[model samples]
Target: MPFLLAAALCSVLVSVLLKLARRLEVDVGQAIAWNYVVAAAASMLVFAPAPSALHAATAAWPALVGLGLLLPTIFLALAGSVRHAGIVRSDVAQRLSLLISLLAAFVLFGEPLSAAKGWGMAAGLAALTGLMWRPSKGAISGGAAGWIYPLLVFLGFGVIDVLFKRVASAGVPLGAALLAMFVLALLVSLVLQGWRLARGTARLGARSLAAGLLLGLLNFGNILCYLRAHQALPGRPALVFSGMSLGVVALGALAGMVVFRERLSRINLAGLALAVLAIVLLARG
Candidate 1:
């Protein structure tokens, strides 16, 4: 429970930091790139993952590479969603991505459907519609463009979750898999940033470096605590899952409202409520 709490806190803190990064003039791309470096280093140090096991033939290269590409991309999307949609909506969108993952399970992997899952999916779709609604003009914020980020955040995380599930099913060691993915992600991020730097489109700054380092620590803490939670509750992953999902939504809403003064309409709040219920249902399923 302590581990689960810590993971939830760290997850929300990541969004808060990213929200602040804009105000602090931090280069998000640079920070995210450097974040991978820090995360990879921390993962290697803490897990002591065997490098020999990462050989191309032994490792799940395709899934690892896919996650590597998706991680930074979805991270950027998360930041964007936090900025435009507020942490409340962004966090809900992220957690509700379980819906998409469940869908993928049914479709791609042919996982059996249950009554709980059916109800959860129905509620989750409604939650998405409600969360994305902006009361001001009967449309989502950022016009069509603004809505894309959160939608992407939702879909992107779901896709990443699916990949992780596949990797886990293949009997890959979690630590080694994470290490490989983070290292690959760092390389991919560097290449993208390098291109931007050459084009004079982005500049790396000291603030970006510092923020990236901090973000890396928080990000790693989130993963560490989450894994610990699973370790603590070996047979009941659903408890950890529900705890994490609910904790983030509740805390994120409070933080966005109190610390950031972000506003949410009644419909948005309703969506958040439904999201929480949906997560509970999915956990039961």
Candidate 2:
């Protein structure tokens, strides 16, 4: 239970750090690239993964490669979503990704859906619809792209989670797999940032490096805590998963409102309420 709480806290802290990064004028792309370096290093130190057991011919190389590419991509989208949609909505959208994962489980894996899960899916879908609906007539900075970023966050994260499930199914050690994925993502980020640096589009500096280090620590903490929760809970995976999701949404909303002074529309508030209920139901299911 303590592990679960810690994981939830770490999860929200990632969003908070991203919000702070924007305020501090940190280069998010460069920061994220550096973050992967820190995360990969941390993973290596803590898990001490053996590369011999994770050979390309036997391991889930394709999935690992895909996750390596997708991690940074979704991370950038998540930052954009938090910037444009407010952390309250962005966090809710992210938690609600369980809906997509559940659907995929039913369709792709032939998992049986319980009545509670069905109801939860319905409520979650409604919540997502409400959260994304913009009744106000003011123009956001990136037009529809700004508003759509949350949905992208929702879908992208769901896909990532689904792919991770595939990794688990492939008999790969998660720690080792994560180590490889983080290293790959770090390489990808470095190459992209290097290109941008060459074109005079971005500069590598101390502030971004510091922010990335902090972000990396929190991000790794989130994963470590979550894995610990799973270890502690053993057979109660649903409990840990639901608790993390709900905890992040509730705490993220409070932080956004109190610290950031983010305002949410009535529809968004309703969606938030429905999201909590849906997660509760899904957890029970």
Candidate 3:
């Protein structure tokens, strides 16, 4: 439980860091590229070459590779979503990943679906719809790219969670699994960035580097706690993840109000209240 709580706090902090990175004029791709590099290094230091860890890591490479490939896509889509939709809306939409993974667990992994899980999923859906509902401004609205990006991000994350659980069940050491995943992701990012630099499509700057380092640290802590929580309570990853998502939203809202001075409309305020209620139900369940 404490591990899960720690994971929730770290997840919330990651969201705050992402918002801050934007204000600091950080390039999202660069930040993500560096984040995985640092995370991989940290995981290797913590878990690799300890004799006992080698066997688990050897067996986990396949799932880890799959997870690694999904990560960049998830981050790219999430960043795009945050750019198109507001941060609050993007965060709310991404929380729907929990429902996706829960369903996947039932259908694909043979996990039992209880009434409490169903209710939790319903509450999550209601909260997401409420968050996305917007009052018309009586003008031509944009197309569905914004919505599609976030939905894709949600699906990517859901797949990641399922893969993580599968690897865990297969006796893969979490730290080793994370290390492999990040290393592969880092190599891919480097290749992509190298191509961009060669084509003169992007230039690396000091601000971008610094933001990447900071995001790297935050992401490392976030994944560490998340994996620990999932390992500590394998039966309730969805519940823990829901709590973490709610914490991120609450923290994001507070940060928006304080740092961005973003005012919430009456409807948004109501949505926030429902989000809180959903969290309560999730925790109680």
lDDT of 1 by residue, 150-246 (tens): 7998999999999998788767778888998899899999998999999999987999999999999999999999999999999999999999999
lDDT of each: 0.89, 0.88, 0.70
Candidate 3 Cα lDDT to native: 0.70
Superposed by TM-score, candidate 1 places the C-alpha of residue 88 at a distance from the truth, in angstroms, of 0.8
Candidate 1, which segments miss by more than 4 Å at Cα? 56-59, 137-141
lDDT ranking from best candidate downward: 1, 2, 3
TM-score of 3: 0.82
Better of 2 and 3 by lDDT: 2
Best by lDDT, which number? 1
| 1 versus 3: better lDDT goes to | 1
- Cα displacement (Å) at residue 243, model 3: 4.4
Stretches of candidate 3 above 4 Å error? 1-6, 20-23, 49-60, 138-146, 227-243, 263-271, 279-285
